[model samples]
Target: MKPSVSRSESSARCPRCGNAFDCAMHGQPFDCWCREMPPLPADRLDSSGRCLCPECLAAEIARVAQGRPRGA
Candidate 1:
């Protein structure tokens, strides 16, 4: 498995775009905005095992629905 990007508590830089964004995945509540998003497809994961920022995630979802892969 690939190592994940380093992240501070409640803060992370999106591994894909290097955009700094607030992340609550490991926070007290454990509820995060990503929970509301559709699960990304396994093939689309790129096996990076890291999270994307809001804009990148949204764009990825759209790309998948349109039968396009990342960087296409």
Candidate 2:
């Protein structure tokens, strides 16, 4: 038999909201702004060497989207 793990056991905090929650704890990975605004390459690493929180990441996305030119 195998053992199970909880989100908190490996979950990360939401950089935007500062709320702690697990996004990707398993071996799977996904696109997350918490890691970067545009989301750095999968191989890239954040300053903290860990994934960023969802809240902070979302805020960054919104900010960038707003900064874009009207035509862009």
Candidate 3:
């Protein structure tokens, strides 16, 4: 079953690391912290299409920007 997020929630579990973190996107994508960062490519998304925490997201962006392959 899928996890349920409350409309007023401000945090979420990171799909990549299973860590609970503050997620501005929990209730507001447009104002999320991720909005200020580079967007993750389609191939980097988890199978469930959930957003990653800032740490994982930044790592992915760095990996791609530095010409490293996914998971490398």
Candidate 4:
């Protein structure tokens, strides 16, 4: 049988910025810090389903906000 690999202690490269950040949900989704944050918009997602680091996520949010109508 193949050994189970745990990503709980691993780091992933942010698809947006390429920075490596520790992922709380790598193998523990329910215990991840990201579970508490608002979901990212569809437009922010790329072909990859990888998670973005806090900084990149924030930048993406800001970019979206800037492109929206003032009253939106």
Each candidate's TM vs. the true structure?
A: 0.74, 0.43, 0.73, 0.61
Instruction: Give the range where candidate 1 is weakest over 10 consecutive residues by summed lDDT.
Output: 1-10
Off by over 4 Å in 2: 1-7, 14-17, 25-45, 68-72
Identify the candidate with maximal lDDT.
1
Off by over 4 Å in 3: 1-8, 26-29
* Clashes within 3 Å, all models in order: 0, 7, 0, 0
Winning candidate number (TM-score): 1
Position 36, candidate 1: lDDT: 95
The 10 consecutive residues of candidate 4 with the worst lDDT sum are 1-10
Q: Tell me the spans in candidate 4 whose CA falls farther than 4 Å from its real position.
A: 1-8, 68-72
Give the per-residue lDDT of model 3 (tens digit) for 1-72: 244454335778877776666776546435788889987778877788687877888999999999899878
lDDT of 3 at 68: 93
By TM-score, the candidates rank as 1, 3, 4, 2
RMSD (Cα, Å) for all candidates, in order, is 5.7, 10.0, 5.3, 8.9
Query: Mind giving the per-residue lDDT tens digits that candidate 1 earns over 22-68?
Result: 77877888888988998788887757667788878988999988989
lDDT of 4: 0.63
Error of 2 at 37 (Å): 9.5
Writing each residue's lDDT as its tens digit, candidate 2 over 1-72 gives: 122233565567543344666665343476433343465333333456555555545554555557742223
- The window of 10 residues in a row where model 2 has the poorest summed lDDT is 1-10
Cα-based lDDT at residue 28, candidate 4: 47
Stronger candidate by TM-score (2 vs 4)? 4
lDDT of 3 at 13: 80
How would you encode candidate 4's per-residue C-alpha lDDT over 3-52 as one tens digit per residue?
22333356776765567766766574446656666666776676578887
